[model samples]
Target: MDARLAPFATTPRLVVKIGSSLLVEGGAIRQTWLASVVADIAACRADGQQVVVVSSGAIALGARRLKLGKGGRGSLDDAQAAAAVGQIALARAWAELFAGHGIEAAQILLTLGDLEDRRRYLNVAATLDRLLALGAVPILNENDSVATQEIRFGDNDRLAARSGQAAGAGAVILLSDIDGLYTANPCEPGATLIPTVARIDDVAHMADGRSASGLGTGGMAAKIAAARIAVQAGMPLAIVDGRRDHPLTAFAKTGHGTVFTAESCTSARKAWLAGRLTVAGRLTIDAGAAAALATGKSLLAAGVVSVDGDFARGDAVEIAHAGSVIARGLTAYDAPDARAIAGARSDAQAAILGYAPRAAMVHRDQLVMV
Candidate 1:
């Protein structure tokens, strides 16, 4: 594993997520800080690196602009209203900052469903790629105005991680209030900074007592969760203090953060599958079936030992072994169809089901090898 921080300095593609606390001051937008961030991003682009910024502060900006006190957590409707109001100012602030730097910034708002649906996910990825190709920096934010309980990323931390994965970024820099992960809160006795985290699981113990910042929904816990998502999607992540002067620039030159290296360089499809919050169902396969899948073959109905869970066609599902998940894919058939075809002979498929759409339960294009 190449764990050096310098790799981030020259990384061709980067995702930088700035927290609300860093972007707002006295309950209002801080144009100065936004300008500094834009300058750093411009410097990165000057070095030939493509950059994407996943930013928070819309809610804060909205709340301040509307003069709404921070007492609306009790009502979901009120919170959404704040996000709705803040999103505009947030985008405008970003646009104006980038304009000063002579760069065009595109506001790309996304919902959890956009990332969950394979087709839409790929479309968003393609659009972001095209924007980058055109020398435009894509400013990403969660679609809080439209997202609900079941389809929300909850905070910009996860959104940033997903953006990094979707953009195939080499590194994801999570700028937060704190410098990095520590054995304990650095303000407390016996606390020490943990410079490197080779495995995400290693930091689980350190995240227990951490709490969210007053200005942001995500705390250190969310940052760790985001790191796990980024690592699983084959991207390295660094959590550093955004409060520092030129945080991204300094972190790139010196290792002043908790660096989480990716486990492996998985393909984009597999990364998408791995990052999903839930699978629709499971397709159990025999040993031959598992081997075929491992060899990059499509999953045929004949190899399925059983199907479990209620799922519709085009929904994500898991391919399992004795117990563990071996793969995940978009099912070509609904639950009833899949259940009826499991363990059935290929020749008998049409006879039993009265119809068949190809023989495979999932085509190779829809399947992601675990």
Candidate 2:
């Protein structure tokens, strides 16, 4: 494997995105292909890797039931109707496929707002984290049935990118009909694959290219948009050919496709957190918590000595120690709740918040040391 591609191979947790074209053929589920992928995922889980699958195919499946064409119904209502019907079948297929490998499949549906809104984003992150911790493969998809066009992510490529962030995934894989980015459309002469993308903008001109298989709707442009989101969050995103059987298996071994490394985004993200977002609140931590934060640990509520400001769950807050701003990050709890839980014990958090799976005040991934 290429050293630049090492992170994709060694990531402890990964998000694999399956496009509708890869999952559905003429409106029916691709059973054999899906089974093979599930087997690979089971193997990954056995090796202590947590995997999340963000799939797109509900509308396609529903179109089959409605006798509609590959483009699905022309109107938004028709599309939503198809999604409502197809989502059930899609979820069922995932559950059955994973069940074959003795793995439980958990379905999670979300609209764009789920990831855009801080409070909802925290809830989603918590849910995804808990599902992975319980050793279950979470099958996530856009809530197309209920999502209005105004709030829709427009495509699953962006949805998968957001899901990766919500899941705190180490890397993302976009399984598409095309192998990866190319200098020109592969059909044209002198076209060649660009294996590693260090910066998305340099090769973004190729975004105008069409899908080679003509089976996918997102095209290269959508994938490029997805890569931007992934890279900005400091995650390596891989765009690989998924039309073939056992794509993940081959990808794990060879990684033969275009990968957006965005190696610099890790530091970039920290920089963004350290200065980009407006500080809505401030948290003062004890020396122990300050030590933990210095070592790159999450800020647990137990370590918080005081909370200032009326910030919401998703608000950016500063971590202060000894009258100095040590770090900054998105908060997981609201002002009242954080104030209530300040210095609270971990075991007693549930009792205090009256909720399950209360996360850190600031997760390490979002925490930026200053």
Candidate 3:
């Protein structure tokens, strides 16, 4: 157990990353191991903690279902096909396990752009918060079926850290085949595990670029990359040996893995958004919307009186009331579409536009009062 890992119990929100090897064995799902991990999540929930899972193994499961040879699928198309088939099975497996605990599992697939784009990032962060509020555990995976090479994140490790950042998780855990960072390959004699990492850069050279499992893409180097992201986002990260059952619980008790302390604290969510985003346009809101914003309520379409500038969906915009700037946020509709639906009831969105997407002109989660 590591002495510096005493703060694990206090985390209010946690993001857990389950690797492919931890979930799949012999071309099949590791049901017993998964059940134990689910138990760990339920326990966390019981203690009033919100949990999100960033999981891998879809392509592996899909390949097994299609009976593809184990070594590697030949091309991106082959991998995409496998992921398309396996994603369903993976979702079902998670749903079934969570159902036993009276917990709902929500599936969310994302591409690399979702995190990189400020508007899309805010939308995703809002969605994660909503799911947690509704007592549902978000199960996120890369949209591998539709992701091309240019937009693909080859490993879930980086995605896990991004998930924590998006959801404002207090902690991030990576369950892997190896417990922690090692001075050298553990398979070789004289290699020793490093219990705690105060600075990832100092130990960056210790990563031994080990071979990845046939079912997985990330290696130790990828996990290191993830740790860097988590620590920068004000959350401690742990890399634990997850080959055994009750992995999370074991970690809680022993704290035997390497804990990477956060180097800095993240700013408030709205402040962070305000600092990073560029306004795309402006929306003139009525007095009612201005009042609602003060009360932390979502900006409704009916409150919007005018739309200014030509901006597309998921673009940041300003909200003005009484000829004064009130707030800034991401718009759910394009400028033309916003004009068509402005000041209309949410229920009227479908009729006003050919197809209604979201009810809010700008969801409250993405909006920050200026």
lDDT of 2 by residue, 1-370 (tens): 6786677667888999998888888779989999898888888788778999998889888987887664564778878888999999999999998888888999999986777666787799899999999989999988889888778787778788778877878889999888999998788999999989988779888877355444445789988888877777778899998878889888877778999985444554463454232477999999999999989899999999999999998778999999998888889999999999999988988898888636698999889875
- Superpose all Cα atoms of candidate 3 onto the true structure and report the RMSD in Å to 1 decimal: 11.2
Task: Kindly indicate the candidate among 2 and 3 with the higher lDDT.
Answer: 3
Query: Model 2: number of clashes?
Result: 0
Model 2 scores a C-alpha lDDT of 0.83
Error in Å for residue 66 of model 1: 2.5
- Estimate the overall C-alpha local distance difference test score of candidate 3: 0.84
Arranged by lDDT, best first: 3, 1, 2
Task: Residues 1-370, candidate 3: write the lDDT tens digits.
Answer: 3446655667889999999888988768999999999999999999989999999988888888888775225678878888899899999999999999999999999997887576788899999999999999999999999988878677888889888889988889999988998888788899888888998878888775553575788888888878877776678899998999999999898888888987666355554444332466999989988999999888888998998899999887888999988777888888998999899997888898878558588888887765
> What C-alpha lDDT do the candidate models reach, one value each?
0.83, 0.83, 0.84
Best by TM-score: 1
Worst 10 residues of 1 by lDDT: 71-80
Backbone clash pairs for candidate 3 read none
* TM-score result, candidate 2: 0.72
